[model samples]
Target: MSDLRDPAPYDALLLLSFGGPEGPDDVVPFLENVTRGRGIPKERLKEVGQHYFLFGGVSPINDQNRALLEVLRKDFAEHGLDLPVHWGNRNWAPYLTDTLREMTDAGHRRIAVLATSAYASYSGCRQYRENLADALATLEAEGRRLPRVDKLRHYFNHPGFVRPMIDGVLASLADLPEDVRAGAHLAFTTHSIPTSAADASGPAAEHGDGGAYVRQHLDVARTVAEAVAHETGVEHPWELVYQSRSGAPHIPWLEPDICDHLESLHAAGAPAAVMVPIGFVSDHMEVLYDLDTEATAKAAELGLPVRRSATVGADPRFAAAVRDLLLERAASERGIPAERCALGALGPSHDLCPVGCCPARAARPAAAGADSPYA
Candidate 1:
């Protein structure tokens, strides 16, 4: 049973995200957490930590999550939704386990999680589920009654999520010189996962060669591009690109890195370009360093005009979308027919991830899915 205003069956909403370093001292440790199982050396991690140091050793993700929490709370209040929103990160302070323990201590038995990642991939979806399982296991070890957790469907194509990106692209295009505005090419970018992982993303059947990761990004890019053309009356040439690639150089990941893509565009004599980060929910380290600092520098060197569009960070519309998602899922859980809103080719993603969805390299327990052990 559920209360319409309270979203019963779900007493709390957890905002889960990939945490980042808050200061110079936290950088190496944060990186260690991110690459725990990987046997990368500490020196290499410190070298990688230069990106954080460049930005005063602070990752914008934590603050962005804080702002998002504030907006989600405000939006919930305004809309009469009574669910309390809590923030947690997989790798940093206010960690997922601690937050879940806090929720349990407060007597929340049913919880809904909204990961900051918008698309489906091993890291994006299943890893978070695994973390949830880990947290629940820890609670069980401590003799706490673990809560049942459900993850919200992927919102990459949700109108609330897509619309802000569209507006951002429009704004970036407007910022370009009038001469190049009509001819500017749109580069839709996302984080580059290993090719094998991308091949295995989403449900086992639905995702084909490139898997759901690539397919989802392409869908968002096409939808946004088509909308931009419809509004501006110029069909700007666009292609899905990848950024923020990490891991062994020998291992293949998504290709045409944004910097390399920029070089290509410059060589091809494109007047200008706009980078649309459809992959990230907010302007985190990847968006800031990979695109803004690194790729922007590359574009500058190539004498190419480029503007990085904004991510949907704490946008009121996104907050409203979150509210809509919580309500929609709540109704569905109660076996009531609820309007599932989505834009673009892909309809709403599955409410619960199927077994074998986004399989990890080594199988681990995951919560909030059909394969979740907690259930």
Candidate 2:
């Protein structure tokens, strides 16, 4: 009998995340780190930093990641999974390179990375891989033995990820007035990338017409809506919407922003609506500022009753799902059969990202994939 809990051949798990500013003084530097190569002017970046400044220049992401780390450690310990988990960020302190060096010094040879982003896109998926590759390169230059790193598949459709949103939608609907409850529409929201990037998401062959990014999001939205319908006995009309778009306005990006969608719903005489942030893993800046502050204000102006649903922040179910994912991948690595879990029509994502998966505008080495130089 195979013990599924054995996380062998994987000495450590890394909680890879897109880090944010911790304080007012850290905001500009953090933004500088994010926009390093973009050649954007410093004043322009300061303009962008205003969003962070509004909340005293603090981003909720780092704190949420901290909470998640605690939850994952607790979950692993309680479930008898001995794998040690470490965290690293892309655009802030405790940077990926420094964390990798620490992990190597600590003698963790085989590492499995769980990125905070849960879908397939260059920024969401491949860029994280690129960061890992960059970190490994630094270690290699320093004459340190680089550990083998592998990223777990996207968990957007995992029951542990989706079930919470479904419950959130239900809770939001129940909170609405009785007259508007049945007429409430569902707005499934995610970060909006450029259309070109969206088209290039996922494997090379799958690129085109929204590709895996939009498709995966639609799948999760459908599953959540169906589950909500089943639980409430009311079929709510839902539409997948986009939010938190950055970059040049001349370039095309995903459309029907949450605020716009709310306006349209109001014009259409929809009684109420629920903003389900299916794209985010936690209630980070995007969710906090974009949805809660901006969109909520828009809904109020339009006299549209709106409720922003909860994210899977520090949820124990998500922690258990991470454990399940690690064990399943470990089992597969050991040439053992394991049941991969997911929801919706997309099924489980591939364990290893294939060549050209979520290709970047400029080609670069990405770790933990078919084309990884480290591999």
Candidate 3:
């Protein structure tokens, strides 16, 4: 459906991602970078940083991104797709601004950004675009050459994104005891955003009303469940659950936390459960701490069998999917509307995010929108 042979509109690919601390020393600084303008107190930040501290002050995301980068590079080479790839993070070293400066100085223009996030929610989508815009503004102020940055479309429903997840769910189910396999439930987990933001996700969001954010997750959960049922003939019942919610309790957020859902399933006598982290691309800190540590502990207490499936980290299929989207976008840039691959009903998201799509704050610059900042 995509042509890996052409990358005319894009000179280089930037793997834009949410950065994490590499070590204990980087924890506070990285946290500060993430919460810089939000005025979050050091005390609260320290509380949150403990999660990273527990894991030796490192978040698995950076290294995971590195692995993905290598895979993308290797896949491109193997497929004869000659495109250079660069990386930068929003909250850590090799920061976005510095990366942009480096790319511009290296004489690369018409950059295509593939954010690690694959959905349409605020944090997953808009915030990253805003981060890219801010990085561009900083570079512009520093007298750097500006590159036209276009983001790839959301791939929540894309088969490249979904197939691996189905495999993951099936693997997790197989891990359950043979006696319990037929009755296992699926808990599809994702990061929980504020309900207001969730409502405002995607185009023209107006309230905490479950916009594209919830819809996309549900579509994926259903698609995976249906496919798993078809393959295993087990008809696993599944629910979309939220995780890593950090806002004040007064501010509503996506709920039925994974652990809580596990408790309910246990009480309801579900023989076993598979924790499919369909929401995340990697076993990031949230997946590591929240699912691996916290939720696993809860399941143990309930005497419920559980297995947390691996995320799609550097899966060859996923890397190829990225290539497909890149080529598709490049083709469209040259006036060819290439066919897209999406497993769920939503299909592929907009190449250019519609105006008012996934706003994280009341005011901010965003790229790939109507009059995008990158434009």
* Strongest candidate by lDDT: 2
RMSD of 1: 1.3
Q: Considering only N, C-alpha and C atoms within 3 Å, which residue pairs clash in candidate 1?
A: none
Evaluate residue 163 in candidate 3 and report its C-alpha lDDT on the 0 to 100 scale.
Answer: 95
List candidate 1 segments past 4 Å from native: 1-6
Q: Distance from true position, residue 343, model 1, in Å?
A: 0.7
Order of models, best lDDT first? 2, 1, 3
Candidate 3's residue-wise lDDT over 1-375, tens digit each? 244368888999999988899999899889898878789988888898999999999999999999999999999999887889999998887788888889999999899999989888888988888888888888889888789999999988888889999999888888888998889889999999888888888888433478888898999999999999999977888899989988679998889999889989998999889999988988899999999999999999999998999899889999989998998899989987788888878877889987778865768888766747667
Error of 2 at 74 (Å): 0.7
Each model's TM-score? 0.98, 0.99, 0.97
lDDT of 2 by residue, 127-200 (tens): 99999999999999999999999999999998899888888898899898899999999999999999999999
lDDT of each: 0.93, 0.94, 0.88
Candidate 1 at residue 171, lDDT? 98
> Which wins on lDDT, candidate 1 or candidate 3?
1
Worst 10 residues of 1 by lDDT: 1-10
